[model samples]
Target: MIGKRLKRLSPAIGRAYIQLIMELDERISEISATQLQKQLKCGPGCDGCCIQFSVLPLEAAIVAEAAVAKNVNAENNGESCSLLKDGLCSVYEVRPVICRTQGLPLAYIDEEAGAIEVSACPVNFPDDYPLSHDELMFMDSYNGRLAQLNVQYCTENDIDCSVRIPLADCVC
Candidate 1:
C-alpha cells in the first residue's frame, strides 16, 4: 500500500525521500525546543522562508508524497502543502525539515575564509539562542544529501531544477 503511494508521489522510481524528512522533523523538534522557544518564536503567518528558493530535498519529497498519497491531481498537494494549513503546519508532528530546521542558525564551511560563522535563518534569531552541541553534530550528519534525488527526478522526467516557484503557484 505504501509502496504504491510512494511510486506515484515520489519523483524517482524508487526513492523514499519523504520518509527522511518525516524522521528528521521529529528529531529536530526534540533537539531544539529551547532554541525554538527562545529565539525562533515564529507563529502563524510567518512564512518568510517559504517565499524564498529553499526547497530542501525532503521538503519537496514530502509535498510530492502527500499529493500521491492522496491521489491529488497535477502532481500537487492542492493545499499549498500537505503540512500547511491556515499559515500553520497542520502536520507539525511530521512536518518537513524546512519547518523543523528553518527556525535555527546555519553554519557552513567558508571555502574562501576557511572558517565557520553563524548564518541565521531569515525567520530565525540565532543570536538570541545558539544551537547546542548535539544539534550541530546531528545537522552535520544530515548533510545535504538530496542532490541525488534531484538527479534522479531529472533523469526520470523533464523536471526543471532552477524553477523555484511558490507553493501557492505550484499546488493544485
Candidate 2:
C-alpha cells in the first residue's frame, strides 16, 4: 500500500525533532518521576502501552535513528519494530518520548492557565488491576504529547501527516 507523503526533512528538521523530544521528556520526567515514586520495581514486564500505539514521522525517525545507532536489524526485524526483540522495546534508552511518558493520569497545561483533569487508559494496569493516580496522570500527559508531536512534525514538514492506524501500519 502506497502510504502518504513521506516528508523529507533536512538536518535541521531532525534536530528539531530531537529537541522537542528532549524538552518534552525532561518536563514529563520531572513530574511523572516524582509521581511514579519507585513504582517501577513492582512494574516488571508491564508494557501496557506498547501494543496499542502509533507514531509521527519525527517519532518514527527517532526510532529509526536509534535502530541504526544500535545496529538493529531493521529490514528483517522492523516488521514488529526493531525495539520489540523480546516482546518489549529493546532500545529503551532511545525510545520515543511517548514510550518514556506512558501510563499515568495527568493535569495538563490548559490553553487558559494551570492544569486540568485528565484520564488514563484503564488497561494501563494488569487485567486484574487498576492504574494508580500517578499512572493515570502519566497516561494523559503521554497522549497529549503524542497529539502535539505529530502536529509539530507535520507543520515542519509542510504536510498534515495526521493518520491514526495500527503501529504496524506506519513506516518511514
The candidate that achieves the highest lDDT relative to the unseen native structure: 2
lDDT of 2 by residue, 130-166 (tens): 3444444434555565566667767876755675433
lDDT of 1 at 71: 49
The whole-model lDDT of each prediction reads 0.49, 0.54
lDDT per residue for candidate 1 within 1-172, as digits (tens), equals 2212222334343345555555566676665664455555566767555432335333454555554455444323343453355565543443445456665665566658976666566556535655665544145434445555555654454555454433322224
Model 1 TM-score, 2 decimals: 0.57
- Candidate 1: clashing pairs of residues: none
Residue 7, model 1: lDDT of 24
* Candidate 2: regions farther than 4 A off: 1-9, 32-35, 38-44, 68-82, 108-115, 121-160, 164-166, 169-172
Provide the TM-score for each candidate, comma-separated. Answer: 0.57, 0.56
Clashing pairs in 2: 104-135, 104-136, 104-137, 104-138, 104-139, 105-135, 105-136, 105-137, 105-138, 106-137
